[model samples]
Target chain A: MPHATRIAFVGTPNCGKTTIFNTLTGLRQKVGNFPGVTVAPAVGRVTGTNTEAIDLPGIYSFAPKSPDEQLTVGVLSGMEQTIPRPDGIAFIIDGTNIEKGLFLFSYFAELGLPSIVVVTMIDEIKACGSTLDDIELEHILGVPVIPVVGNKGSGIEDVRLKLTDIKEFAVPNKLAEPEADIPARYTSVRNIAANVVASPVRDRRTEFLDKIFLHPIAGPTVFLAVMALFFQSIFTWATPLMDGIDSMFSLAQDGINTVVPDGIARSFLAKGIVAGVGSVLVFLPQILILNVFIVILEDCGYLARAAFLVDRAMGLFGLQGRSFIPLLGSFACAIPGIMSARIIPSEKDRMITMLIAPLMTCSARLPVYALLISAFIAPIYIGGFFSLQAMVLAGLYIAATLVGLLIALLLKKTMFRGAQTPFLIEFPPYRKPSLKNIAVSAWGRSREFLINAGTIILTLSVILWVLAEFPRANIPAEMQPLQAAQTQLEYSFAGRIGHTLQPAFAPIGFDWKMTVGVIGSFAAREVFVAVMGQLYAADVSENDVTLREALGANISLASALAVLAFYVFALQCISTIAVLRRETNSWKWPAFAFVYTFVLAYSASFAAYHITLFLGG
Target chain B: MNINELAVGKNALIERYRSNTVFSERLMELGLTPGTRITLVRRAPFSGPIEIAYGHLRLALRPAEGDGIYILPV
Candidate 1:
């Protein structure tokens, strides 16, 4: 059996490298950490071939400015212990800007690897009235030049065929030297471009569009409005889909209850597995919806401009403008947000961004926030267009942003004091977002969410069930079922622990039941609602009213606000801490992150509880 | 004058690098060598980073970093 031929994809950022990789690999991709570090390298086996493709992080050159970039160079040079040198390289080049691509390509060509050049953005190049002669390019570079419209799957088959014969590929006797001076290398690249690439007239349409999009006042306003619609859609658009999923799970639970007789098995199956996991699973629609908007924003090239727009505000906190992209990504989940921080060139700034990323209101917190807001705040229409609930939701996001900025400022002043890093970022030209790319990204994110539900949340749900179920408490003979259930929960281990922990949480207005939810949610912040559903004996499908009414009857508006505040500041997700530890390569920063966030959560919750009461909530 | 003092939309020729740090080296590798032609595209709103175009590449540069690049107006 022949070993799988390895091919590595290398390119400058935003050059459609990942899109082409996805097109070839489809569902065969596996995202894992490179040997010793937490930086993820996406590896996938090409279909119907013995070739595997590794999508390295998008980088400009081999001179490593950051840790993530170092991994790319290390792997390519076979200097890394775990990563093997590839047999072939798929060097992606942006079609519109051939000069910069050629400048970087010169370094890789000198490595003398069996390589092929895949030029992306051919459509964009044509739209600008330019043409690239791939035959001419191949003649000049001594490699196969395959021009591809990456998002549309054009030229993909040609790339696949070339990879199969990659070992047979010929190389020029004389290749560019890596040690050449910068000016000389650039001049050579320009010379090559001058031969095969026609200089097209610059498009003025982008300039006209940028005038409004990059305007001082209008830009931020448009960004805010875009964000507002994004959040509102998370609430409105996901409702029907969420209901459909809730009903399907409810049906499955009923079917299980009818078939499995009344026993520990039945209880465990229906309550532990279905109810516990199903409650958290219902938020999938919202997560997918949020990810779709983010994908579109990124694909359409608006994200870089957004970074440019907020650079001044971020600079005030001693953060580089590049921090904006990672922080925005945190709204979907902190793990990706933390991972995206790799793009920040400065180690200090990256660490600071990761530390504060959890402060963004992630999709996990949506279930808890929605439940609390619906139960406490009346649904009044604001300005006849926006609901009061939406306004409150937006306000919570704003509050989180303000708090994150404040913490970043404090950290910069006290602990991570340093000179601000440079904000050198590329602004790619706008294009119509490809539906294929959006679907792939959204699908990948949703799959990851479900996998978490299956593994981590599933195990925790069973443990939580056992903690709230066993030791065989005897029920009073005359009590109703709901009363008997409540009595049993109060006698169980988790209930006892909650009772013991109540005093510590009481000043923040958390009752014993709420305390139990808080403790259960340590593994994941979204598990709080599920824990409440189990404890209250409410059917998971009826979480909207059953759990809501139960919570409303027990807690005041002050307590609800405090709970929201706690989630806003608390570092509640275990995965986030684990990733932080891995990314920082030390236990110290993760420990510090957990402690500081815990203190902030407690203090803020205490203050919110008292303030709401004082304000006559 | 340094890059920060260069007016927006004005074309300039890269004179020399004022800093000898690793970052400056990286910038030079990105084709910002001496005598390269560049133009200040626009300064972001509220004193944000300066945007500049060199050849076909566009980059956003903070004022502090921009101060290290000495340029002569075209």
Candidate 2:
């Protein structure tokens, strides 16, 4: 090849193809979308080599069920425009499932391109007292068969050497005909396995684990426990890291305060740049922790089992099992949750999941909910265990969750109504997950989140800061600092716009000040607390009793509950909208999500406020 | 009988697919062609997907997909 040779790595899902790709690329990979498609595949350069490796989405056969599978086939067959056809193909096969691997390889061999077969998960096979004869297999298939432990880096150099030397790869002339029956291909694969695979033993350990993990009762129980652990780990473990990030930004603001005089530059530095970036990065810890669990669960082969366990319940709402994890992840943060939807092979299920993800009461909404509930709801003990305020907070979460699922069901019935896609998942034998692989995968996801969503958040923060800062009004010299600050805010552009929107927001019980708080929160959900504190000119925090009492004195219980209802359904976070746009590769879905959610928030809050007034609250 | 009708731990040989379509063809390409031996491993709780082992590979398929596979008890 005159130019740098591009080698495509193809394999079935859960065949360790990603592990091999990561091992070969070594943190040099970049994800880019295919031309005319939203499916983003990772492309990386082979370490110390000029060859480039493209990690295609894993598939079982060439059958194109989903858009991703169709894109994979398009790229492989050279029908795709932007991604030029690769000079060679690298077929990564799981050693434990040689027959299935070889079956797909037979099709790859027909591509008439020089190709090499790399057998992964050899260690798993060896632990079962079985071994693969790569040489004999190579002789039978008329190709090079290199067996390697992908995660452990065994035999990787040989594969890399072969990759660089594409001319040496065996280009099969004939095997199965284009229209050959499935039996014909399998017969050849079976005959080849007979000669090369010795002592093919069943993995008893996997069977034993399945007995508990897949048990009728134990299965669902364990799945619930695992999910609980997933949320607990991300929330409880990520707090300290998130707090560290939060304080680091505040310290930077303090330093800027001392050095930079009180002016536009100082405010820009402290609020627009520092606080904006901090708000975005504060989520990094939770994203990292969330990705770690996903990678571990997926790598260890339990994610499929998790899917299987939840398929029936998800099916009730027009989704399948795979939608559960993404929706579950949304409870932590919708950015990572929407990103995780890439794993759902079915387009319908993925879209429904992504659209409703923001309504799942993410961690960002916690402070706002805490503030509102504390402001209005009484803290009287309920049954000597649950406080009334705590119960109301939980009720808001439950209400949002139900509304999200209800919308999903409605979408499935209206927008995506049609024949359901088949759910066929391969259950790879359980193997010990690699920490290196988990770290690498998590790092990649976190990086993607920061880069793709971070820019939008930063821009929104600056704009909000400008809107709140401009059109300054002079304060009387004898006025208090807080009062002067409040007066300045009331004269700002955002405050004027809030006054303009008073008529529109009046039905939902929002005064001009509350409307300003709502507008400020569009940057992020938690910013509502800070905005309300600023509007009232108190050093506002979720735990500050001063701001709580101020809100209690000014805002009626009806308006407070209406605000809570509005937050529960609103897609206020721009980061979620950005991620949705990135994932869907179209403005249509994200735009629709924003419109639908705003309507929901408006109607729900209207009902809440009027109903409370009717009940004389 | 269909593969879904087979008892857990019972071995069966694939008779044929109930129909010829992309869905069934995909199953056939997964090494489930006629005359192959498969054993029902287990079923997920609350009538979820079913797991089956053929050769060294295990596959989880929803019952609707499983219904498309005809089987003969061995």
Candidate 3:
């Protein structure tokens, strides 16, 4: 068998390192159009070839200040046991910023490995009225210099063919020790850069956009406008798709009812299996829609500017600018939000961001809030433009965001009090986002959500179905169908448990039925609405009737508000807990998050119920 | 004067950092060493991070770190 060769692509952030790696290996590593997209190394083999490529996270130098940087350092230094040292290194250099790239490569030279320099974004350099002589650069750096426009796939064949005989490439001469001082090495890098690069001009396009996007007052206004559009698109665009999925599920349920006998087996098949699958599939549209916007914004480099605008506000919450992206993403779903927190360099800041993410009131909690608000709050028009009910909904969103920030502040003060990590970010020049890359990234994120969270939601649905189905009670033959369902659930395990636990939640104005819904929602936040619909025999599907009216006739305004308050703060989604466990590599932090949020939810609900009662609710 | 005091769009030569911390080391590693020509591009609103250019690289530095790097007007 021919020996397989592994090559590592390394470079500073925003240097198009991942782009070249993706081109060579044919693997789309999460849209390498922006910094922090490739926070972890992605390994893939060259299609139909024996060569493999490893795309490491971008780093400025061998000195590691962040976890991702440490991973790159560990792998390159042969200290990481899992990732074997590569046979060769592809030192990716940015054509526009060769000086900075060479400064890092000076450190790479000390590794003494067979190396090749692949210069990316050559077109960007030319467009900026600069010229780079790759032949001259090769002569000065003493390695093969291949200039490639990565996004256009030009010069990639040269890279692939070069990798076949990479072992024969001559190692660049080492000019300094591994621990050499930076300023001295940079002097040598400056001399080398002076030879190959001519008439370097600042990127005029980026500078022009920055004037408006980064203007003190205009910058924040543009950001807020963008955010409003982003969030509005999620609900406006996703509603039709969500409604389609809802009807499809209802049709399947009707099919089951007509085909199967009216008995326990039919109930299990229809309510347990079909409903479980439907619940999982219903969330796909919202997830896909949310990811589409995130991918575009990140690719265009606007997200970095948004972070810059919000850095001061985030500082008051003890988080740096990097934490804002993850938190903004949390409003869609905490799973993606938690995963995006990988971009944060500091471990403490990352953890704090992840811990408070659930409090942002993810889309999963939207149904619960909607059901409660529609039931209790009257849709009275205020000022002829705003509806009181809609205002209440907006108030809930604002409250959740404020509470999330406060929690971050509290965690910083008590648990993570220490010297602050430095906040340094590079401003990559804006480029038109690639449609294909954006599509692939959004699809990848949606697929990940389906696979990781889908199984847990499916399993929990079946478990809750069982808890509501067993220990069926005998109803009088003349009793109505709704009465029979109520009787069966009241006698079932979930019902009995709810009745037993009612006294504990009584202070928060929860009755036994609401208690059951709360317990069921621990599986997934939207399950509360489903459980309530089933218990009342009221259809909660799109354009369906009676659920809202039934709930309104039964519960008071105080209890409804208390329930809404509880949903705002509770960390009830098991998928989020599972993601937290995976991200932190331990159960301790997830357990802490769950316990503290639960305590906070209970206290907040108690306060809301009594305060409303005292106000003559 | 330090970087925080440098006017936007003005040029200067960087001097030694006031403190020998990791933050300063990282800035120097990014080629912000003494004797390098630097330009204060802009500062974020609310006295947030400041953007500076040296050679071909543009970096955003928090005020806390930017305050430590002294510069000589040129």
Candidate 4:
């Protein structure tokens, strides 16, 4: 491979910048935001014989105030002080909003950075009765205008071609800007567009949709409708796909069992690798689906609208107007939730957001909650639609959000010891969401998550299998498979470790098994179910070995209730811990989150279990 | 007061911001600059968020944020 030319991808939020990046780089990427920023940076190599592509933060302009956007300007000018600079910038302009998108391009030109323009959503432009003259644009900008229909990948190969043939160059065709006042820049850019372009007044559909969707009373109802649809999509809609994945892994485990020897090797093969990892992998479908919708909302520019629409109400919670995006992301996983906080801008506000974000009840907690509730209190009728057990799961999730926000409110009043930050939000122009863009982005993120799980989750599971699987001398051969495994687990390092501190959990009515599951969950909340699945059955996906049968056979309803309470209140995903460490640059929040969540989980579960039993009696 | 008491969607602009807050960048990113226009969209149940349109963008801004904007009618 020849020396990789420095290339950077830059644009505004939801501009399909990352999508374009992924279309270029696929899985060769790393994610980090600007230093001390939570808005994530997706750095990837568009590896080829000679070309390497770098995707930077999506910024609206070179005069960036947000730290997230600051990297955009810094990186393009070869002044990304913390990181390497780029040789060329591929400026992605939303096709329908060329005039507005040009604002940033104009900024890059003023800085004399060589840039190539890639027009995203060209299809949207045509549908809207507009056209971009790439030749004229190229002439005006003096850079090769690569007219890419980013959503269709109609000209992606061409974009790729130009990237590979990049050269060290300078821009001599940039427009000069006088003074540094930001308002002047907007005025000037608006003036520049007036001379060269004429599109019809506003699109009538926007006003039509806005009438009902943004209506006074009807507007909020519409918002609720849309959000409910989003939630249902996360839970019910993703189920079948998740089940399909679950089945494949189950079949694989069965296949392994058929050929493998039946002792330590069989147990480890069926239990540790398949069942353990399989349980975690089932959730990937939901993660991917969530990303699909998220990417669409972001690209179509409705996400900002939703943020603006709700900012007035969420602001009372001391969150920024755009907090909805990050908060919604939390429902999928807290890593993105914390990462999205980069948009908050203010140090105080951003920190508060990161602190409370983990409390949002990520989807990873759903399986554990479902497992416990189904085995314990699934009544004959649920909330009249969902199963009664499912309602409880939903209730627990909602309750966590309220209680967490309540705690944040209390903390902001005292511990934070800072004044309330003023907040504002922008609502960018409406545009058709690019399907190719959204698909590429979703696939990219899902790929990253699966990779993280493959390496981190696998290593931890192997190490955990060791902890649960040694000291053969301690167990008698005649015991049942589970009993034998339990004996070994009890004698193993993991079990001894659980036994050493058994007194602490005893108050919450936790058995050594529950203690072990909770400890294992430190790596991920979903791992709790996997641990329980392994502890209770020979393999997790064995049809007869449902979560119900496992917990039901050994533990009483009340103990099951305790476990439910434990998962509900405990913030136990290690990815969240890792992200918090990186975001806060400390061990403080994760440590605090673990300690307090354990405390809350224990107290809540203990209270729930005993109280339920007492009431029934 | 109803929106008529204020101008047609014009941002009230900041008078005095509460100190040590980092929300300025967030507001700026959202296109909530002073002298900007804000068109009220909708409100959810239980006194939830109010959706609004600003600078060709749309979202729900909390009432507290509106109050913080400290708008004086144009």
lDDT for each residue of candidate 1 in A1-617, tens digit (9 for 90 to 100): 87888999998878898899888888778785566766878898887777889999876677888877888898899887888888888989999888878888888877878888899999878888889999989988888889999878889999988877666555532335557877788788888898887886675667677778888788889988998889889988999998998888888888997899976798899889998888888889999999999999998889988888888889888787789888988999998899899998888899889999989888889989988998888888978988998889888989998889888898899888888877787878887887877887777876777788888889988998898888657987897756666777888898899999999999999988889889888889888988887876532333344677777877888998999989888888898888899898899988898898889889999999999999999
The best candidate by TM-score is 1
lDDT for predicted candidate 2 compared with the true structure = 0.80
TM-score of 2: 0.88
lDDT of 3 by residue, A328-430 (tens): 8888789879877877878899999999998886877767876787689887887975667667767888898998899999999999887676787777788
Tell me the DockQ of each model, to 2 decimals.
0.70, 0.77, 0.76, 0.25
After superposition, the stretches of candidate 3 with alpha carbons farther than 4 Å from their true spots are A1-7, A19-40, A44-53, A87-90, A113-116, A139-144, A155-179, A335-351, A370-393, A419-421, A475-479, A529-557, A578-588, A611-617
Q: All candidates' lDDT scores?
A: 0.84, 0.80, 0.80, 0.68
Q: Give the range of the ten consecutive residues with the poorest summed lDDT in model 2 chain A.
A: A537-546
* lDDT (C-alpha) at residue B55 in model 3: 71
Descending-TM-score candidate ranking: 1, 2, 3, 4
TM-score: the better of candidates 1 and 4: 1
**lDDT at residue A185 of model 3 (Cα atoms):** 86
TM-score of chain B, candidates 1 onward in order:
0.94, 0.94, 0.95, 0.61
Residue range A409-497, candidate 4, lDDT tens digits: 66667667576554445445566666656666787767766875677777777777777776554666676655655566767887787
lDDT value, residue B18 of candidate 1? 85
Model 4's DockQ score: 0.25
- Give the CA lDDT, 0 to 100, for residue A110 in model 3: 84
Q: lDDT per residue, candidate 2, A1-617, as tens digits?
A: 56888999988877889898988898889886566555778999999888999998887777776666776888999998888888888988889888888888778877888888899988887888888888888877788889999778899999999987788688864557787767998898888787787866778999999888988888889987886576556545776886798678778967997999987898777766776666557667877887788788888889878888878877888888778778877876798688767777677888899999998888677667756776787878879865676567667777998889899999999998877768777787888888778888888877865773366556666676787778878879898766766677778897899999899999999998899878877767766755564455322322324556788988988999889999999999877887788788888988999899999999999999999999998
